[model samples]
Target: MNATDFIVSRNDLQQCKSIETQPPEAAALPADALLVKVTRFAFTANNITYAVMGDALKYWQLFPAPKDFGNIPVWGFGEVIASKHPNVAVGETLFGYFPMATHLVIEAADVTKRGLRDGAAHRQVAAPVYNAYARVSGDPAFTGKQGDYQALLRPLFMLSFLVDDFLAENDFYGARRVMLSSASSKTAYGLAHLLHRRDGIKVIGLTSAPNVAFVKSLGCYDEVVTYDAVTSLPADSPVAYVDMAGNSDLRERLHRHFGGQMKYSGRVGLTHRSTSPEEPELPGAKPSWFFAPDHIRKRAREWGPGGVDMRFGAAWAGFAPKLDQWLTVTEGRGPAAVQQVYLDTLNGRVPPDQGHILAL
Candidate 1:
């Protein structure tokens, strides 16, 4: 098999590189491993977020790459072409976090009705949520129908759903208005869609002028305003700020404007990759990075085992059907096509409503 890997410069992520490797026979795969032939995955700003925070989150440690290069993690569907594990058979499909490569060998363990976690030695310290792969045949969200939608939104929307639930559970930190930066972002929209339905609080979307119309069309936010218009919002009202854009200046502006009324600041993503590294504080509650795993663990304790799955699955069912109204799935095949999609996402060249389904 000739498998290709997409690598990005640690210094300049905008520059991408690909390496193709030829493997021996399938019989050469390790006795306890499964070789997955990656089928499809979504390449979005979320993947950029992973690249940007790779070191901090230790994502780069998951699938090691050569010096000066990083292998960005992605969520996708893959079929096991060769396996030596007793429980996992060849031909079974799995969906979970995977590197942007044509093939991966998973040291499978903890096999269950749901799926098995990749027990690769390097992954022992990684978050369990990303380690577990679900068999599509058994996964209610991806079974047979709607597999495209699942591949596109499941990873991101799950984070959005969890973030919304976390904020709601905490009563939006006593704020009557919820402000989301990067409203055009898929994760931002998913949360906005949920908050828009909540009573009392207003869901406000902050986006660039170019994306203002697109964000407005989602109808997920009660109000849509460009970053230039952020000052138009009242300063005295209690507000919960969700910083999905991760631009330092934008965050500081919101902080300086809202002052103490900015009830909570959650630093989520850096879609604006040029965002300043040094934080300039003005006035507000301290911004906390929203690590999805921590929140997921807390909720699991409060809601019981599999509680998240039950709630997210129900919400996903309802939201999945409505995707056609907002998103377009575009298929890109082979290594070259996949490379272009990766570049498009890194350079923020992809359209707001288009979801790239990369196949290899």
Candidate 2:
């Protein structure tokens, strides 16, 4: 059968195309292999971060593409149409990392009641989180609108959960206030929600003027300020900066404005992709990249087996319900709609309150 894939240029994310190719025949499946038919996936600014940091984070390595193009990884659901693996059935559904294509073939390993890992040789070196797939039938989070919310915000919220844990684990780096840039983004606001519940630490959201009302509506941030009004924030108080926008100019401005008062700076996303790659020497804490998988591994060692999952699940139970009131899910199908949504997300045209689920 012909598989359609949407690929983007490695050098220019704006340059993308949908191409048709042949997938492996179901009858000729290798031992312990499963052919998953891609159904739908969520696309957000976070996916754009995967593209922007594809090389640095090895995202491009997950799915092979042409020499100059890449198949961006996304979190979504798929059905096992054909399986040579004895433990996995043909009709089972899965939730995990997938390419922007119609199908995927995974060499299933570590089969269990919960899920299995894609033990394909090429994917061995990628982060373990991206390599794992969960069985939808056994997952409690698969019911109701949970699947859509999971597709849209679970991954981002995981990062938010980790960031909040990381900060609290360090006693907020001796800061009384925590500031988040790109405050309107899902990840940022998710972090804000967690931090807002904490005592003594005020959550401040730095956003664009147009998004001030939306950010304020979340009721998670203590103070919402526009980019131009960043100087209005008191520089005397110790603060931790969690950056989601990755705007170099804004980074420099905040660093200069806060100077020694900037206790910790964690870079998480690149919602603004045109920023400079070189970060000049600044006065405040040096900007550091926050890789969620690294933190997950760290927590696993400190918390023992399934401890992270237990804590995350509890947090998600409380947080997931709030999203229904905050997000409006919009569905898109086929190549044209997918391409348009991709472009809209890439150009920052999608609203912060809307979640996009697309099928190719």
In order, the Cα lDDT scores of the candidates are 0.86, 0.93
Estimate, for each residue in 233-349, the C-alpha lDDT of model 1 and write its tens digit.
Answer: 999789999999888888888899999998999988889887887776679899889889999998889999889999998888768877889998898898789888888888888
Displacement of residue 316 (Cα, Å) in model 1 is: 1.1
Instruction: For candidate 2, write residues 134-155 as lDDT tens digits.
Output: 9997566774468989999999
Checking candidate 2 for backbone clashes, the offending pairs are none
Cα lDDT of candidate 2 equals 0.93
Candidate closest to the true structure, highest lDDT:
2
CA shift of 231, model 1, Å: 0.4
Q: Where is model 2 more than 4 Å wrong at Cα?
A: 138-140
